[model samples]
Target: MRGVVMYKPGDVRVEERDDPRIIEPTDAIIRLSATCICGSDLWPYRGAEPVDHQVMGHEYVGVVTEVGSRVHTIKVGDFVVGSFFASDNTCEICRAGYQAYCVHRVLMGALGTQSELARIPLADGTLVATPGHPAPDLIPSLLAASDVLGTGWFAAVAAEAGPGKTVAVVGDGAVGLLGVLAARHLGAERIIAFSRHADRQALARYFGATDIVEERGPAGVDRIKDLTGGLGAHSVIEAVGTQEAMMQAIHATRPGGHVGYVGVSHDVALPGNELFMSGVHLHGGPAPVRRFLPELINLIWNRTIDPGKVFDLALPFDRAAEGYDAMDKRAATKVLLTL
Candidate 1:
């Protein structure tokens, strides 16, 4: 089989590799139908995250080709979507709706989904089978439900975006744009998107953003405050993991508001004194994507939402390097790899 492997920072290649098999009784093998690059993956591509000869890619939606003896809910021939983290959804932590922190968890990127085949552990709890094989066009959206959509949804949920709430999103990437969409779907009365790109601003408007702030740093926070009558947004979504983005999010949110940060924090340290005085709620980490896959799949399957629009580039699985390059250069919001 062929899969993507990161040889080091700024280097990734599609190379021949051994195929995967069920090494655990709870594992299942999936033949990739589609997969995509993630913003977090860029940390390694840009050398922020150290890399050796490690498998790459994680977002995936595929067909189950084999199942281990312990797998029951998922079976061979089932079309499934799963979170980046493989988890036994029934664990005590999972029961509390935090599957990303499940005591028994496996990071799927360790096996790499940007390949023709993948081994999914905890198949019963991690993989959610669609009602049936979906149409070809639906594949992209279904694939988004596996990661980006679920993560964005989790951000919106954590931010408490809903009716009567004023929401502000601090990123223009796929996850951030989808956070806008999720906020709208959750019934946010006002959605403010921070972006300067014309295309992204247009897409954000289509996703239900009522305002767009092109400024950066303090200016950006001021613009958000100006839009909200100096009180700031009721809910803020921080999709960029950086000190600047984090502070912008904190400043754009009103006192007693919520800030849901989903960006993979690279080098960030928050001041406890400021946080204590901010009078705002902060909650984030790896999203519990498994908790929202079912509802997200339903929305995508029914065409109620089109999160797949995020994939501005599509390539054959073999051209994954080019896909990575496109994203690293910010030429594409998201890149999808088809088998």
Candidate 2:
């Protein structure tokens, strides 16, 4: 089988690799139909995050080719969407809707889904079977549900977005863009998106953002407050994990408001005094993509929302290096690698 491997920074290649086979009674092998390059992947590509012969990619949607003996919920020939974090789905943490922290969790990203075939552990708990083999056009949207859409949905939920709430989103990447969409689906009355890119701003508007603030740091915070009648937003979703984005999220929320962040933190540190003085609620981490997979799949299946628009570029699976380059250079919002 051929898959993506990162030999070092700025050096990702598609090369022959040993094919995956069932190693656990609870595992299943999938022939990937679609996968993607995530913003997080760039961390390693830029050498901000270290890697040594790493198998790349986690977001995927595909057909089950074989199932383990104990896998009953999913089966062969079933088209599915699985979470990036594999969980038993019945664990205490999962029962509490935090499958990302499942006691028996596994980080599927480490195994890599950017390949022709891959093995998925805890298949019954991780994979969600679609209603049927979906139409070809729905593939991109369903693929989004696998990670970016689900993460954005979780961000909205964490931010407490709902009818009558004024929400602000930090960042304008795929996850941030989809955060705008998720907030809309959650019924936020006013969505303020922070973005400097005209294309992203347009897409943000299409996703229901009422305002766009191109400024960053304190100026951006002021802009958000200015748009919210000097009170800032009631809910702020931080989709970029930079210190600047995190501080923007915190400072742009009104007193007693909530700030939900889903960006992978990179050298971020919050001042205890600032947070103490802000009088706002802060909660976020790696999103339990599994928790929201069902509802998200339904929305995509029924054609109610289209998160697939985030994929501005799509390339063949073998051209993953090119996809990575486009994203690394900010030339693409998100890149979809089709098999």
Report the number of the highest-lDDT candidate: 2
Model 2: per-residue lDDT, tens digit, 232-311? 89999999899999999999999999999999999999999999999999988999999888899999999999999999
TM-score of each: 0.99, 0.99
- Model 1 worst lDDT run, 10 consecutive residues: 270-279
lDDT value for model 1 = 0.92
Model 2 is weakest, by summed lDDT over 10 consecutive residues, at 223-232
**Model 1 compared with the native: what TM-score?**
0.99
Local distance difference test, per candidate? 0.92, 0.93
lDDT of 1 by residue, 239-305 (tens): 9999999989988889999999999997889888878888899998899999999999999889999
Could you list the CA RMSD of all candidates, in the order they appear? 0.8, 0.7
Q: In model 1, what are the clashing residue pairs, if there are any?
A: none
Model 2: residues >4 Å from true position, as ranges? Answer: none
Candidate 2 C-alpha RMSD relative to the actual structure? 0.7
